[model samples]
Target: MKFRRKKSGYAVIEILLAAAVFVTIGTSIVYLLIDSGYSNLQGRDRVLAANFAQSGLEATRNIRDSGFDKLTIGNHGLALQNGSWAFSGESDIDQSGRFSRQIQISAISADRLLVTSNVNRIAGISRPLNITFSTYLNNWNKTTLLPPSWNTPQIVGIGSTGETTGNRNPFGIFVLGNYAYLVADQPSSTGSEFFIFDISNPQTPTLTGKVLTGKRVYSVFVSGNYAFLTTQAQGSTRPELVVVDISNPATPTIVSRTSFNGNNYAKDIVVVGNYAYITTLNSNSREFIIVNVTDPVHPVTTPVGSLELGSNVNALNINGNYAYLATANDSGEIRIINISNPAVPTLVKTYNNPGLADATEVLFSNDKLFLSTLTNSGTNPNFVILSLNPSDLSIAVIGQTQLAGNINGIALDEAGNQVFTATSLSSQEFVLLDITNQAAPVIKSSLNLIGAAVAINYNGSYAFMAVNDLIQQLFIIGQGQ
Candidate 1:
């Protein structure tokens, strides 16, 4: 009778354990459901935020396309009033309760506008999530398109002194006295590497001599009676500086070849006094090497006197006691070296800016440092002008203008107040800019060449361009008043 009574009901401890387990499982399920809901809401907010941000950008662009005067500096909200896009001082979208958008317009130049759009999501949260987008919008509708006669760029003549071998890759060009030396890449079977053109007749250029260097020549600089060239390495041979005696334009001969310690690939060379400053890329390192070329027959490298730039030095220009080196990297940099004492050069100053991305060429003239850069988003691909203080080597940006393509070379005409740019993009091979007012550079004329313009040099009234098109590889552009 006692056993029957005990089994009729469960123990108190068993009931307590069962209750605890049930409570634990119920709590976990509730928490997980709450977390999942929160995550879904956050994602939804992000999607809305992005959509609203993009909408804001489209509204700004629409306003710009309609009229540049519609956009003004400061914060503004886009709205549709009376079935038309209108900007309001308040930044709240009537349809989007949790979202707010604003746009800011800044004038970069008289014709350029820097437009920025921002969207914020405040869904009853302490911290609001925000998204932003920005771009430069030029007033293309208002842009004045000048005719070719405004800049007066006339084609004087065409010459192909080194195109007989079927390789029309004309790279570096140097005009000295009555002769123009052009360094071109030839097929391995051709043997000839560089060509000399008789330019005494500016209208007609005749190939007078061709020399074989057994290597790919990239640049050539003439000094006195010698032509210094920088060549690309062939096979296991390291690149070297080849000195050619051009005393007679009809027959030029290589007198000496100077090699460096590392596997150097010379990109450019500038001769100052008795030294030859070369911008080279050795292995992965970049530097400017100094070689003593006092005696053209036997050149000697300086004793650890190379200036290491730590970036790819694309172009170099020596002005007075300073050398301006334009290094092209993710963030373009201009390194100024104090070559006051050429033997032991020191880094004097370095300048960098967002507009200087991929600086391909540099020219110092009229107390200004002009730099040409590759095409990059959010940047004007044209050349940037900076004021240079010769006393202390200080630099300040004057302004920037837009060019059509990637500028590879820049030839400054200080006396003529013009800047010639050689570009590599199709349809924008050669460009002429009038720098009469350094603060505001306007495009004078542009020539659309069939080939890519690789290099440009200005002498007197003519600009010699090294082109790599299928038909014409060399062009002489006459700049007329």
Candidate 2:
């Protein structure tokens, strides 16, 4: 009679319900714990990566200070390889006649090798460095006599002692190799002179020479011994393309001059290998023309390539076999062209951007194409990096950086790792960007040029800027010992 009550174990439905509730609670708790653990790991990994990047930078500085002259690729710190990190080095030349070393480091993750850092060094001339082993650091300031060979930069603004307020403005600047030249649009009462400056001494840049032109010089391109000037001619809609022999840095003589009756406004010109690629908006034709300038004096028009664009071509940049052109009055995109065939340049691709792009400049560096948008998103600027497949001529937007001012002109070191941009829409300064990581470009520092900088060109070590009043100034940037 006793145990017989046969304790009918709890009903099947009740037991099943209890088990279901327990399983649900356990699953939620496990998920939360896993998520938290992953988050913590990610944060720690990021911190470690940053520290590693900074360490690599310091290592480069040490090597440079130690007088390891001519450091190139494959010459990196072993500490970087000890961890999940890697780096590459390159030498860059700026317009200021200074040598710069660019080192890029990346972090190795489970799925990706994320680029995390860039280090720039101002490589001093390769001379016998004086070093002594000591426990104390030497005071560099003790030396009152600065290096006589080193040069600095000064900003020059528009002068109106007795002229109209807005008569002439510095519109363009060009550097004939290491020398600098400034061009003013329709100078005030003064002739249309290309004011040349001696940048050998960057700080106190001396105005070397001034040459009068047939028309207002809009843009210029410099070859080995010549400075090609693009002029905006009046009366005749067609602009004159003049080539001046720049063998003499101070005084340049016109070697060849050609007037295109069809194209009225020639925007820019670029010389590559042995040919000059000119971009212009012909008043009558209403298209961009690619003219042949292999023969400077008698520049003949070859098979002209035209793309159906809305506005005139404003900026053109070339690297290797491709030509990047920017068209549109205030807002536009960059068109990629295959210029392998000098006579017949073919259109490869086009990128229609929504950003308010006025003067777009492009440069190729570190296997990436950098597009600097002058005034995109109001006054805020941005540097767009495009991953370009040189083999197929295809481009994809990979990395970008938004900044504070409008960019006018852009320049880069030989490796395209260090980028310099001139601005006008804001404080009229020059910004330096570390583009070693093409996908995540960063603005490392900015210099207050104190003028509306219209154009910039770099030769690896120095930066040459075209500021107000058709004045060209040179700045030497980098950590100097």
Candidate 3:
């Protein structure tokens, strides 16, 4: 009558099953909590690493701004001691001790420094993470003007215009007939952004017309009754090629606009016949893009027409069936591309010389190539003249010369037998060279200006120079004896 003792207790197997279920659930919850905490920590570390890397870069810039002599080649860490900034030749970290920072200063030239900042962190969950930032710092304040002996040139009518502050930097210039077009940035102002000046009187350039592009223009090229302009790339606004009809320059209108993809930035352009050859920098590579502009109102880019180069292309020139490019980086190279077939451009040859590490501008005149280069780490020629054998793509160095500063722009007057160069670092901003003796070129005159000479264009009697100083924006240099 006991009913088998009512199975007084559940079977041992049942109790064991219940306990196993509870253990499994508890273990899963604990593991998930641990994983979430680890993920949060890893993300925090990454952000901290990035911040430290940026701080290192700023510190290096501060050192550079303080004095060029303060920078030296090697690993360095910024330390604040005695209410002053100092550089220590040791790897240092923040208060957390989890992030370490260091900097490397490499001398690219006498006045140029390539700074690299690095931050490292190790969290044990993965391999060490390293973040880096790099930039070139030039001694913009250093003025190394050598007194012009006897034949030094002089600037006659130097004038200043435009906004002195707030992103109103004048950058590009193009002269056609009696008018000169200037592209500048007017970020804080209204109205037209591009300006037209009546340079018919070089001594007094009067502003006659202006047109708005709604973006910062970096370059301008004129042909027929139209003007083609390239703008700087910003956040959501990609770099573009804009066509403006200037049949009546007083009232210019935008006709066509073309946008580029994948971090493409337009630096300079040259037009030949019905095609426009543009040199651009795409992320870390250089590209040559050819656009058919026969229809000015509807410019079309050639299909699969971009050719990649070794490094950034600074300046380009087109002659006959060839395009010469000045590609630069730690080293410089001159690339010749055959563009006889606009749709299919081909690289013909490349030339590299010891003194050609910083080729900034290139010009072709009468089978001779004028390459404006910068000296390397040591003493080398900053300007080079080469003879181009079109049939074989062979180049021979005819003459080489060194200047007190880096040459940023070059222009030639074939009829006058002169070469005008705009320099950045020298005491003289404008240099007039007599290339009449191709093999033994002589400097006719050098003039010191108020600002760094960035771009120059010669039109028979006068040289229009784009000056990048806070005050003076442009200078009209007349030929002086």
What range of 10 consecutive residues in model 1 has the weakest lDDT sum?
159-168
lDDT of 3 by residue, 1-481 (tens): 4555555357777888899999999999999998877765665566677678767877778877888888888889889877666798666788877788888889888887888788888444465677775666778676465553325454555444444334555777777788888777654446455777777777667777677777777778889888888776522245368888888867888898776563566767877778888886546543688888889798874333678785777778888888998877444478888888877889988878575466778888888898887544466767779998867878998987778777888999767667888888656888888877778777888877756787888877677888875434668887442
Which portions of model 3 miss their true places by more than 4 Å? 1-152, 158-161, 185-193, 234-239, 284-286, 301-304, 329-332
Candidate 2 residue lDDT tens string, 146-202: 452212222322221111222356667776544676666764445544666666655
Any residue pairs clashing in model 1, and if so which?
none
Measured over all alpha carbons after superposition, the RMSD of each candidate to the real structure, in angstroms, is 19.8, 24.3, 15.4
Error of 1 at 431 (Å): 0.8
lDDT winner among the candidates? 1
Off by over 4 Å in 2: 1-168, 234-238, 281-287, 301-308, 329-332, 378-381, 414-417, 469-481
Error of 3 at 318 (Å): 0.8
- Top-TM-score candidate index: 1
> lDDT (0-100) at residue 14 of candidate 3?
85
For each candidate, the alpha-carbon lDDT, in order, equals 0.77, 0.58, 0.74
lDDT of 3 at 273: 77
What's model 3's TM-score? 0.65
Off by over 4 Å in 1: 1-150, 165-167, 234-239, 301-304
